[model samples]
Target: MESQLQQLVRHTRVHEIVGDVIRVHATGVALGDLAEVQNTDDEISLARVIALDRNLASLQVFAGGKGLSTDATVRFLGRPLDVVYSPNILGRIFRGSGEPMDGGPDLSTEPRVKVGGPTVNPVMRVMPTKMIETGIPMIDLFNCLVESQKIPIFSIAGEPHSELLARIGFQANADVLVFGGLGLIFDDYYFFRTAFEEHGVFARTVMFVNQASDPLVERLLVPDMALAVAEKFAVEENKRVLVLLTDMTAYADAMKEIGVAQERIPAVRGYMGDLYTQLAQRYEKACDFKGAGSVTILTVTTMPGDDVTHPVPDNTGYITEGQFYLHGGIIDPFGSLSRLKQHVIGKATREDHSQIMNAMVRLYSEAVEAQRKQAMAFELSPFDQKLLRFGTLFRERFMDIRISMPVTEALDLCWKTLAECFEPQELLMKQALVEKYFPKDVGPVAVNEAPIHG
Candidate 1:
């Protein structure tokens, strides 16, 4: 398909091969440009230019470099890597290399769009004032996920972060969901697909998966591929898009491995110096277009050894708006925070939402202290006893990750939890909210009364 001049530019002198990377002395090659490596057997493989020094260009072959010989013919495509972007992509599963893997249909003829584009301009972005409710009480009641907000779920291995994320995917109030799974095993990959299908959201979802056995270069492309498709849906189709990426630590590890292969000097913890910038580039893709729809990013960032100071979570904490601390199979109220929740706490939600949230969290904090006192065998005051009761009700009703309810229902339940353990006047909340929302029939019950189960 190439013109004679284009064919003349093909270079056949690959000088070095390192892991999945190969070096060749070539001109007119730009970073990120696509290339075609044709072996002597005429077997062709795709590659992308990763680095350029003088006349020597380094590329990471997509199929890998194991079978590639130094005499392979390299032809620069003069374009960056791109992914298919179309409504046809919905309900489809793609590999990290942008190839269709769902066995549904061929997307080779679909229109393609370049990945890793620049972030939306500030002037074109709308302020994040709208709330995107996920039926989870912990998030909806305390830390609201706002439209166009970028946040991460901070967790460690052995946690049910994937389950929580899948719950949000099916329950979140979004028109489309884009999921990127980095270094997932077959079981996790199957779990996500089956969850979405069973929940009837698979038709509106697109999945990009990079399993543990996939090439490392593909792992680096999953985020960009997912974000690119999400932006297209938000901007062109005018649809609210929620992008979910799990185990970004694996993505970071791929970058570290590629850097080592390139012989680049390591920064902190052996990660590249541009670690923050690379993360921000993808996260900044979350934006509410002024006249169109929005993109919200929720990712899972596993902390190595549960250490917050680990380079991945530490850098992420700086780039993201806030974090949902997932620990002990529940969202920890003490550590979880949503900085943009203030934007919609009262304006978009009910009038009593703010007061109820504050009072409940304050009571829960006291309940934690009361627990310590009881654990130490200290004499408990009646108020401490009340705090202890409120804490139990709080965990069963709201803290449990399995509980799902609407914002209004959760607010009403909050009042009931308060009234069950404390007098209305003792709430220290706005007097009018107490009068309106406090359960009318429920009075202070005997401490020995049976607790309500969620």
Candidate 2:
């Protein structure tokens, strides 16, 4: 005869079966009163038992769902969800359930572990000082990416956030790249896979992808799997891992769906009340583990209608250190920033880096105002006239996303452009830097340099 605990779990119907409400009796607690849910399509990792009665047990499912049946069996496992972890997870992919989707091998045979664990205490945290060079001029020269840093690419659905993530994965100085895709289109998945393969970094990269076609619950697991694998690599293999997650909005939406399933009171915007805490837990995973390689998180948050005030972005903005805003094709310098850049800019990079970045953006902002004035047909002042020419050159030369140059070369180009367009005094850079960096003026020639005005 089976034990009473086993028997209790066996008879109880999975709350998710009829809806998302489990039933357990007081005696069931001794037999691990919780019921194991049988989710045929989506992965439902047990989170918590929020509300429980003598006959009813309400559980929170990590991966939210829409198609669960209340009649499904909820057998008590007497345990929480666990995910397997190890340095071996590198170059691997997983579903939101932390199950392998890479067509390689099943991790079921290996010991499984849990994701969304508690973060490290602040007392153990060390100040971050290492720089991660992506070779992207906008990122490297201005807002330098740092180890253990958390940054988000804030964009709308149509923007090229995935492209940017792939670019960083391929080029970032980190030893390993773990990519988590949630609610991604098939094309985006293919694009990331192709980009890494073409760059020959696919072997060093792990992709945990939850496509738009996958179960919404699965989409929720992508980040946890990616982070778990990254944590293993960081602690055991001593690898500097960069974890990239996309479209956190989908993850939040999944939460809302699951909350509805469990009949929990909705918080702001129908999101779970724990939204901020949930985000902080994941983002706080970025850490420079003592005596080990660091883990950095650079995820994408797509703002619906480009509204930063949207809950997803709004919460993310508070949690992440900084954001890289992508609009049109270029990373908008005005909109993007790395708060940790202060740790690297000028201090770790070239001395001219900080000044050049500041000068360039200041000029760009002035150009925007000038363009607005131009649009309004305002009479241009001498400085505004000069700004007009500078703005045109800035877009064609610097702001174009296709413009890829080494950090040093980009700084030199800035000096050269200024020399060509304006006298040294107009540049407003330090007098000493002007003398050292400013390219030599093309001196007047007798007749060759002069245009013959007839």
Candidate 3:
């Protein structure tokens, strides 16, 4: 039964078509409202109102506008776009359109929740104090991933950013994982699915994927759908949710393409001026709800041509908590940072965690300088030799992305690595911590020793 309002707002007059966007002379249309566009052949495609100008509305068709006629009927649904949410969605894979991609049972009848809503109230959010361990020494030991923190891994092409994301997805201590892949190739998509299934974490994971061949509008929806489900799990089910998004650069590009189609004025580097606002809206979804579980977001923002000043990463830096700079197949300790780490470094972790992190990074800085001097063929010193040896061991043992271990075990190994090269007094750490944690029976580490395991 069509209400009087719906009947009054229906129009069979699409004035213009540009790419996947259509402009219609329809009144009483609201931004973000979902509409059904019925073509001349009676085929209905979903569209969402993107912009409105007195009695004129612009809609971006979800299923591309290849065959959409100018006279297609546009009927607004009087509501916003939504995604289905329920426990049954676990272990299931969904397309960016929120349809089931896996060959499984239908979920169309499940409960649906509106996405892209306002962020959680500031009063309802608690201070982030809990740590989410990823079992990666570079992350867990040095740059701690605090619960409810929103962060990104900044990398360029040819880096193993996806591999690092998958490792954290399977190994991070979280109750549910929601993965959103934007503009992924078939091979990259397959790798994430296979990694989750083989590692036995798929049962607790939900995937929203938009492949390179999919419609551009769908790419923008992937993050919203993933975050919507994660918010439900956190507030309703009281579960700690971790949302992982890869290649947000793709998402921002989709917005640029759509904005160009709409003939809107482009901002910096041909991107929309609202790029920061859009990214912040999604990243701010990460929160620790008071008296409920938390939602933490970790994203991959690839810098084109390794340009840090690129619009996507430059705007993201201001919106996110911090970033993990992945370069040369390893997480660079000097480039990566976790701003909220201060909240949990000593409170939620071991007593020696704070001192150990500072001491090791300080020593590694000196080691880097020593290597530079050696490269220039400068005068050799005994301390410089020791620093060189420590640098080699540090890279081999801790900097490798493949190395995974609990924070405690990694901290212990840090002490051993230090003791192998430098004396106890040389470590400018607290005398008490040094006396307590310094390796007592220090000996040469075997070259064939197995890498640390989680």
Candidate 4:
């Protein structure tokens, strides 16, 4: 007869192994609990309880499920996946598993917080009304990134998406930044670290990196771990936290791969059926606390072959507030939008911000049409000549991704650009705004010398 403790322990051999998942016939197993799988050779692999039905539990092993037989033992650890959370975590780099990789001191004594926890309640969420400025002209002047807004960078392969993300991470005005890198190559990862260190923002940043060479199963955990720590800072420490996740498409790919291995029914593009819900669970973490701080999420979701209809970006568009479309190494002003921007424009910024934004984009549109006419060998009218000149100045001064300045300076530059291209009467802005902002002299007003009125 077996002892009472032996019977209660419920150690069992693996029933089946498929790809990176193992099925164990065990009782009293809960979802998300950590487990230890030991093979006949006593080699151990860490796994998590992903699905549980009746007496069978499906576990995703961090290490690939290769060379494993039915004789492998599965022992339940009786805990969910938790990551170390403390002040020390900042200025340190960690693997996707939340283990420190920066050659720094171990964070063994720090408080461990469970990853993939529930998002903040809707009742506790406050309406986002503050702008998180990144000093990028296109973002600040056109589509301002609002606090608690979840947005993605829509880009294709061979774009400078990573560089753009690094610039925001280094320049965004936030209390703390949590960066999560999923399926990034070694060069990209190095670029992010080097950029952060060189720009001197590494001290307030915590990174959870899942490199291309790391276990594919770990790619699924990076976003959750980064957001978990960010939530702790926002709710407990009362710090405004900004979470940056790069290449969520890779995360979805990992999910699809695991789904196939588990024999699950496929949805669109060979993805799981609950793809939208899965993405919402992560993006909804962006929240502004009622009386405390906020967590703003900015992610990069690559469109495979630049197809917006792809499952990953298609699903993302539904969850996020808006997207920044990156093309031709610049943020496409016409393609990008922020739904929450109206909540802060003119209220948190200068009085003329909203009007200036509308007028500049409208003229820029006309300029584009004028260029199209010019391309077809049509005779350019006097107004068309003015539009053409405006377009060139707008692209170089405002649309270019390299232009970085404060919001106030950006507003001033807008006036200068408009004044250089058109007279005050042709601007079609509000009479008072045009008279106040339109430069009196021919030369462009110095950036900070212009006086702004409410």
RMSD of 1: 2.6
Reference-based lDDT, residue 85, model 1: 94
lDDT of 3 at 320: 93
lDDT string, candidate 2, 239-323, tens digits: 9999989888888987787677667799888998999887888999999888888899999899988999988899999999999
lDDT of 1 by residue, 344-429 (tens): 99999999999988998998898888888887899999999998888887887898788999999999889888888998878898
lDDT of 4 by residue, 1-454 (tens): 3453354355789998898899988876678988888899999988898888798899998887888888999888777899999888989999998889989997999999999878888999999999999999999999999999999999999989999999999999999999999999999999999999999999999999999988888899999999999999999989999999999999999999999988999999899999999999999999999989999999999999999999999999999999999988889888898999999999999999999999999998898888887778999998887777778778778776777899999999899888877888888889998888777776533332211110
Clashing pairs in 1: none
Tens-place lDDT digits, model 3, residues 28-115: 6689988999999999999999999898889999899999998788888878889989999999999998999999888989999998
Write the number of the candidate with greater lDDT, choosing between 2 and 3: 3
Looking at model 1, report the run of 10 residues with the lowest lDDT sum.
445-454
Candidate with better lDDT, 3 vs 4: 3
lDDT ranking from best to worst? 3, 1, 4, 2
Task: Give the poorly placed runs of model 3, Cα more than 4 Å off.
Answer: 1-4, 444-454
Candidate 4: where are CA atoms >4 Å away? 1-9, 443-454
TM-score of each: 0.96, 0.85, 0.96, 0.95
Q: For candidate 2, what is the total of clashing residue pairs?
A: 25
Evaluated at residue 180, the lDDT of candidate 2 is 89
